[model samples]
Target: MRAIVHEEKEGLEGLKVKEMPERQISDNEVRVKVHTAGMNRRDLAVVTKRHKADDPALIPGSDASGIVETVGGNVTKFQPGDEVIVNPGLGWQENSDAPPEGFEIVGLPDHGTFAEYYTCTEDHLERKPEHLSFEEAGVLPLAALTAYRALFTRGNLEAGQTVMLPGIGSGVLTFCLKYAKAIGARVIVTSRSESKQKEALNLGADLAISTEEDWQEALASEQVDLLIETIGNATFNKSLGVVRKGGTIVTFGSTTEDEVTFNIRQFFYGQYNLLGSTMGSAEELREMLGFISDHKIKPQLDKIFTMDQYKEAFEYIQESKNFGKIAIKVR
Candidate 1:
């Protein structure tokens, strides 16, 4: 199998393509012949060793679509030659501190999908929708599920409510805009570039603004009911500014700075809720796929690169100029 592996934690320099033995499936696992793999910001962080240092020689990719080459003895859901999308997240923990149901994502602390052949536990595989291509299915597990869980499941979004999404480039935010529109919610997306604003408008955003400074002023009349903050320190304070009283804010990325300064009084007095969401459950992943299938929502791809050109792909994402998900065709 052709696999990307890191023997050390020295960033992308450690990532190299090597011919490694393909994985053997366990009694409850299934082996997939990977077709397409999606890259996330976390993949870069993991490759760079900024996060998840427990495993050194990690093959880090979470989203993938492939054909099941073989099924383990205990797996009854799928058979050989079945097309499937991998759900990188397992089920939520049975007992959590506050929330009893909280999901644990894949691609970290476990072997991932950045190779020609990969093994997944049977519970982590979902049937690919008939309408989607392999590239589209490969990108939805992490990004789309995260957006669905944040807005509809965890954030408790309601129809006629207004949502303020800080960034519009990533796959998560793009799907959030699509789903929000389908549910009759007004979406206000913020982009620093005029080109991104126009792209967001084309994708059904109610209002797209290119205000590099004081984005709150861009939303002069709307009071945000739910805010999805993907850009961290750079716009966290500004994102909180336009959110209405009793609104909720869900954050997924800490891209800029983890430490942010905000008035605690404003949160309490305004009665706002600040929440954090990761990738969603397997059930949620399947539901998101169904919605996309029904609505014919296309997974926006910024660029596609071959596995040998993985370095160039990573460099492009590092520049943060892409408007959609970056994909690498593995097989």
Candidate 2:
């Protein structure tokens, strides 16, 4: 099997395509012939040793769409030739480290779907949404699951609520916009680039405002019921400013700049609740996959690259040039 392996944590330069031994599936696991692999910031971080690089040699992809080429003897959910998408997160014996409530995630602190062949538990595989191509399905697990966890699970986003989403370029934000609009919520999005704002509008955002210079003034009179703060630190206060009193603020990642400091009094004074969200569970991923299939929701892809071109794909993501999810054709 050919795979892009991280030989060491020397950044992208250390990533090399090589022929590695095929992963042997255990009796409780199933093997997939990966068609497409989703690239994420965490994968880059792991490769560069910024996040987790415990293993010097590792395959660094978490989300993938593929065909089940073989199933373990005990597996009942899948079989050879089944079209599937992997929800990367599995359960743990320790309850505290377990996934919150209903969901689990893929691609972190575990072996992921970065190779031509990968193996996982039978339960983690879900039927790919019929409406999506393999390339599209590959990008859904991590991004869509995070959006579902943040908006529905933690933020308690309601149909009629006004939601403010900070930063609108990534697939996660786009998933939030599309799902929120589908449920009749008023979606408000902000981006530093006008071009990104236009892109957000095309995806059904009710209000797309440029945050080039404190554009919270655009919504000064209106208050949001929930806010999704991906770019924390720099925009946390502004995010707080736009939300109504008692509104929930769900935070996920701080992509722009980290090391955020804020006045704790603001939360007490405003009666705001700050909720921290990570990726979703495998069950949530299944639900999202079913929902998108039923609703015919499509994910926006910024670009696609083959396994050999993985370096260029990461370069595009690092440069922030792509509009949404960037994928790698692993097969």
Candidate 3:
């Protein structure tokens, strides 16, 4: 098998593609011939040491869709030739107030999907949505699951409500825009790039504004019911300003800086709900797939690169050049 291996937490320089031994499956595991793998901000974070990993040699990818090539003795959910998508989150099986202590995402301490072949427990695999291509399915798991849980599960977003998503270009936020719009929510998005703002509107956002613009002023007539905040310190206070009184704000990532300052009195007086979320449960992944199938939603794919071009893919994402998911064609 050929795999992209990172031997140190020193950033892109640590990454290299090399021939590796094929993975072996356990009794409850399935070996997949990876067709495509999706890249996430977390993959870059781990490579750069922003996110810590205990493993010295790590295969860094969390989202992938592939065909099941072999199954272990105890496996029953899938067999050879079954098209499947990997649920990147481990543990956290069902909806809960919070993930259990032992919960961990795939592609960190464990070897991940950025290879010719990968293996995971049967419980973490799901049938790929029929409408999506392998590249689209590869990018759907982590971002779609995160967006699904953030909007519906944590934020409790409903149709006809107004929701605001800051930093619209990332995979999760793009998914958020599509999902929220599909559910009849009025979606408003902000982006530093004018092109992304226009793209969001084309994707069903009711309004798109520049982050430099005064979003609170622009949206004065229609306050936001739910605000998905991912650009932490740089945009959190603005998010607080745009959300309606008593509205909910759900945060999943801090792409800017983690530390943020906001008016404590305003938060208490408004009786607002500030929630934190992460990658979702397996059940949510299942439901998300069904939702995508039901709504006929397809993930926005920014670009697809061959495994040999992994460095260029990483560079593209690092430079914020993508409006949606960036994927690697592994096969």
Judging by lDDT against the true structure, name the best candidate: 3
The residue-by-residue lDDT of candidate 2 on 176-259, one tens digit each, is: 998898888999998888999999888888888877666567997776999999886788888887789889999887886777
**Residues 1-331 of candidate 1: C-alpha lDDT, one tens digit per residue:** 8877765547778778887787677889899999999988888887775543344677778889999999888999999999998887766522222333434456776768889987978877889888888988887778888888889877888889999887788878888988898888999998888898899999889998764766666677887999999888988888888899888999987878888899999879989899987767666677787888888787778888889998888788887778888888997
The local distance difference test score of model 1 is 0.82
Descending-lDDT candidate ranking: 3, 1, 2
Candidate 2 Cα deviation (angstroms), residue 151: 0.6
Give lDDT per model, in order.
0.82, 0.81, 0.90
| lDDT of model 3 at position 52 | 40
Task: Report the C-alpha displacement of residue 92, candidate 2, in angstroms.
Answer: 6.5
Instruction: Name the best candidate (by TM-score).
Output: 3
Clashing residue pairs found in predicted model 1 = none
Which residue ranges in model 1 land beyond 4 Å of their true spot?
51-56, 91-104
Clashes of each: 0, 8, 0
Model 1: lowest-lDDT 10 consecutive positions: 93-102
Error of 2 at 268 (Å): 1.2
